[model samples]
Target chain A: MAEILTAKKLAIKVSICLAVLVAVMALCAMVGTQKISLKKVFAGPGQEPGQNIDYEILVGVRLPRVILAALVGAALACSGVVLQAILRNPLADPYILGISSGAGLGVITAVISGITWKFWGGSPIAVFAFVGALATVWLVWCIGHLTGKSQVTSLLLAGVVINAFFSAVIMFLISIAKSEQLRSTVLWLMGNIIEKDPAVLGVSTVCILAGIIALFSISHRLNILTFGQEEAKGLGVDTAKTTAIAFGLAAFTTAIAVSLSGLIGFVGLIVPHGVRLVFGPDHRQLLPVSAIIGGAFLVVADTLARIIVAPAQLPVGVITAIAGGPFFLVLLAKYSRKVSWLK
Target chain B: MSGIIEVKDLNFGYTPQSTILKALSFEVIQGRFVGIAGPNGAGKTTLLNLLCGLLRSKAGSIKIDSVPIESYSARKLAKKVAVVRQEFVPVFDFCVAEVVSMARTPYLSTFGFESDTDKKIIDEALEMTDTARFASRPLANLSGGERQRVFIARALAQNTDILLLDEPTTFLDLKHQVGIYDLLKRMQLEKGKTIVVVTHDINLSTQYCDEILLLGADSSYQYGSAKDVFSPHKIEKVFGVRGFAGKIGTEKFFLPLGKFAKDAHIITTNINSTTKK
Candidate 1:
């Protein structure tokens, strides 16, 4: 009876959170660069409808940007939860294993070398970035495998080493790039979700949603994983198989998010960490809650990014870093003192 | 079948060069509280890992019931055998209820929530281990004894016939150690479940366990009733220490005469004689 009541209470709490998210999204939609009439925004074109200034800005510019922010935020935060569990590290995030740097390297090479191939309207750079992410993940796996079975420690170390190596390669690319190429690549690396192209956003939306669902589906197994590899195996989980699937999905979601929007930092790390701090770590609750809260957070941050400088927009990544960096330090200090398991 | 577990010349090693358990053959009958005792390097924990199929043996056969252990699926094997490790340090704050609920992993369908029956079983397990009151507390906040009980409850919630423990009482106070052993004995006798424990305290184990499996410095083992296995001569031979068998209040125990104490006495006598001269 008490268990059922607790389940009901959790449901109520989640519903309330989702309600707040909807209200915040609505508020963000209205308050962007300029206000849009809510009725006009919700009402579709019909017999009495005609193109207007508010309609064009709201539907054309802000809506797609807001949607992209939400999607990318959801993907990064979900990936953080999954990566943290599989890697068995509190500091793990979507980019922790050098996936982002590898993607950045791919994008830089594509832009600098003048590669021109467009499949389904996505820029060649986006496609190449995803490929690079997958390749780096494979390299990490190979290194982890060489030592023995894929121990978490070996995998984490391999990620750290590969991240350094990829960052160096990216730096070399930056050094040799033409001036114009350098400007464009730097903007992409700053991470923006204001993609005006609807076709690219459509494809990435599907990918991100599918990846989030996959992570959520396997979340129960991830809870078992937190107990450690041997314990997880003893509990009937095929630890190797579960960890592989989880890592693949995390990489998949993160790759898609990075390809869509350059490299938004800290949404992954802080959102999941914050969620765990509040909800306690049952991945069943941690995974989806983190995603929802992440979506809402990014929507708010992107809105602030647009209006904070009037006409000129700050990169959403800049805001997240400014906010998340100090917050993470405080969390780290608190965790070191209170969390016995981290040691 | 005379026993639930039958081993035929089982051999295991982490690497090819050194064998941890060599040509081991033993049978553990159903519903027996068996204690495995050895010195520091005797591979007691390794033996428990092998029994639970957490580690694969390179040679020989281990059969659970009539089927080879290797033939069972991980989930199937889990349903039949549950293990309580020495200690667990959780990376996240999981409540006692949540931790115990994880033992239902084998029975739960993929992505399935716990059924009412599963919750009932969990409640019953907590009750059995006297951990019901701590259900809402974080596992990390509990004392060592309390955490140990919670782990036992988790194993109980697994609903297996065989329960294996590896030094479950390590790092626990003497009172907590006795409490844990008492709990295991109660589980075995009252519930008729087969229990296997690994420990360094031969006397406590001998007093509580129905049978004893003694591992020596060399990769060998002896299995028999406690009386046969815990004899003074056997203790001295296997442990390389002098032990005298004695009785107190109709219960038999052994006292170790320390070899280090004799050496210290000789050194002290030499120093005193030289100073007096």
Candidate 2:
């Protein structure tokens, strides 16, 4: 009977998530530059043979951007789910371990130094971002190990220090940058979805997808980890190795998302928490649902960022921040009293 | 050699300069209920950690079913022993059933899906722990005693032969403590589980445990039946108090004795009459 109830709950959650995804995708497709009809949107960017321009605009440009936004959003949200579980902190996000700042630093460094080598004519920024994110996470791990206190607080504090230091270095680089480079760097900080080269998008998708798969595969371990490290170990989880892998995957996905979308925040922090509130904290459900909802949320946010001001696009980061800030405050107002569990 | 758990000359510490456990050796016979007692920092938790392979011993060896503990992988060890620690903080608002299902993790594959047998085990653990009524309730909403029971339920779901509990009654009131002890005793007797509990409540330990291990500073340790280990002399030596043991309603209790005031006069005849009564 309990199993039946759980199955029903899971089914309800999946259906709701699918419904939300469909609604958001439809909204995203219908609200763009031309305000295409639902029929046109559903028929999917191609109807007649001669009218290739509309098809190209719809399929080539808008479709990829929306798909990329969804993929990156899902990746970030799922990474947040795993990280929060492993750290045993509700406030933990993909960026809490310094992945975003590290990737940002790498991108800024590459941009400032004019190191523009492309792998198969793709953006070097994504590659540099991933490498930098992994390197910084390793550095944080080493520091934590050297100190012999790898507690969550110590790791978080280390990330904060590294984030601040990296931000300062990136700022210094920006200060010395030429006008064109400085403008690009500033715009990158604001985050944009335009000009995503196909090759860059493909590589970023693959990286994010791999990280998502790795994380989802260990969803059960992630759930056990929420009981804290010692209990998790008692339950036979190799706490050290599993934690490292989960953190690495979260960092990797966040790095790819940051590289592709340029520091889209709050989606990683908000979407998973929201999903948990609705579906409860079973990672087998939470991870995948958070991913789907996160993808849909970002796709809608990106669409709004495009159409909100027309012709001139607002930065996707700004929209997420604006949306997530209020959502987070509402969350705090509702759940802050219950956070004594942290004690 | 036939015991479920055996530790020999086990020495462990956080650092070389500060040893917590020194040559600690004990055996828990199959299906025995053993209690470990000591003052704070008596290395009770460290010893339990060593037994469960949560912390590697610096010296000596630990064996489960005559196999070197270090030789068993974490999953194998978990299948043999489950620990309910003193501090259990759930990071998420998981339902009680979900929390209980986590105990089946050791028996599951890498994917860790709950099989029909696994679900039955979880249900049984929940029912055994008296948490089945709140199976749908969020764990965060449970009282401290309830949450502690949920942790135990999760451990029970592991279905191990040995259960190690560290200060399981620390935060509970007297009623809850007795309830938990009674539940643990039932589990031991009914399931034939080898149970080891670490606690500061010597009286409770003496009442419930078949064997008691007393740990003290300066590399001192004693292991025997509760009657043998909880004598007045050993109690005074360990607690630095003059204590009197007496029976009340078929239960034994130890109470600290105090010296009379210097200005007060003791009446020997009255004392003899009171004792006779």
Candidate 3:
């Protein structure tokens, strides 16, 4: 019908998704291994120590973890949407930047070297991961630009090579490490949501939110980029500059997420596909909508991980890989009768 | 005035040892339908990419309306030219209107917001291409011909003065082939848009183009009206197969001849001298 996609319409769509995110976060916060009352949240703030364990559990432990899941979810999914567009590969997920392997190498090296795993407020692994992942991405960036032309193909090739090399190192470390260290390393690789310093959450929240806004600003150019490199240039996009901007923003956000959430899988891979399957692939809607839905998907996954084991929590990453894969396939099977995954 | 598009001494290759186009020179006047026809690996597509500024040449210059192409910003150039690539199947399945809306990228504000005028232009493009019937449908739902038409509609939505296409007929049958060529011809005639197509279909180009630029192996080229440029010997030399030229209603067509044909000498016309330009 050639109806106008007015500003009002875009706002409404995003608002609806935001509403759903809020609903999911609220529901997940209510039902954890430990019973918490929503009434406590509305009741007057706890002014003294030894305030009800219910208040401490809800506000300190459960609520922060749920919020962290949402933030990481949003970051990974948003990165997935933009990366798929610019890289011209639907198989590109947050980990395709080699973030998981980079982070994995950090965890494995620290464990194998006999560095205490729980020191620095249980953040030594997170610190190592944040540095290693960012360093690997920086290495890929330099390699992609060695010819003074940072082509997406060059960047992608660099990522693949770096990912393979780092993963091999991680596997070698795991194979030779002692049993106790290997156990901790494996748990770190599997990924989980844990309570964090308020400062870390606040800083990550700012970085990720800014990254989403930056990506949203460039979504229109990304639509043209899907037409391949030469063709995108033919359409008058400054392919080099636009690609650089999108890649840098998406990469930084993915690094921040992995540093915070340790290596949550499948949210980055499945959320964007599910969102694209539901809403068509227009980046204008796809970016924000995928981000909101990605947050909710992870919250639900984390909540189920908390309860399914009942007093013994599973890593949220395991639930994402286990539950999200079948759920995505079901969606694919139901909808693929109409349209293909990609052609 | 020479033409709306001009090129001189253009050279390009992925590397110095593998040059694709060598000192290529050509021009297309405004409102003319020009076809770039050539054999495989002869740089037809490379030349097209050079024309649109997708790839820059190291040796020479391309100009639009006497202004060097490098001087034009990407957005400014996009308003003057729109390109329809060969079989561009994107990873995601955007609907017809959604894909068409992308053509307005160069025209949108820095924030990429659309105005009423952009919507009107999009609507008109759909109507012109006859794709408005399935404007709401996903591109996957359309037939081959319909999808090609939708791509053309996207180009038209750019509202450019010049349009370029690469093998719009690939993977299409005869009817769709004719339909696509007809659409391009109509655009040239009715809308006064300069058109250039790089294609392997020499026969169809012979019927539709005002001028033909036949590129051959080793950088040799012949540019003239189809009548002046096409001949059985040239076809055999370029494509490495013998062919006979047949005439129908002022239009010439080529039919390849091989040793397998029965009694091929009897029907041979030896019309090379008769067809001399």
Leading candidate by DockQ: 3
Model 1 lDDT per residue over A63-133, tens place = 78888888889999999999899887888999988788889988998998887777676568788889988
lDDT per residue (tens digit) for residues A128-200 in model 3: 7877887888888788777445467787888899999999989888888889987878888888888888778
- Candidate 3 error regions (>4 Å): A3-6, A111-122, A142-157, A176-180, B1-3, B18-20, B231-242, B267-269, B273-277
| Docking quality level of the chain pair in candidate 3 | medium
lDDT of each: 0.83, 0.81, 0.84
Per-model i-RMS: 2.7, 2.8, 1.7
Off by over 4 Å in 2: A1-12, A35-51, A116-119, A330-343, B1-3, B248-250, B258-277
What is candidate 1's TM-score against the reference?
0.93
What fraction of native interface contacts is shared by candidate 2?
0.57
Each candidate's TM vs. the true structure? 0.93, 0.92, 0.92
Superposed model 1: Cα runs more than 4 Å off: A1-10, A46-50, A326-343, B1-3, B260-277
* TM-score: the better of candidates 1 and 2: 1
What tens digits encode model 2's per-residue C-alpha lDDT throughout A198-281? 777787788787888788778888888887778888999998889889887887788778778787888988998887775667
Evaluate residue A268 in candidate 2 and report its C-alpha lDDT on the 0 to 100 scale. 85
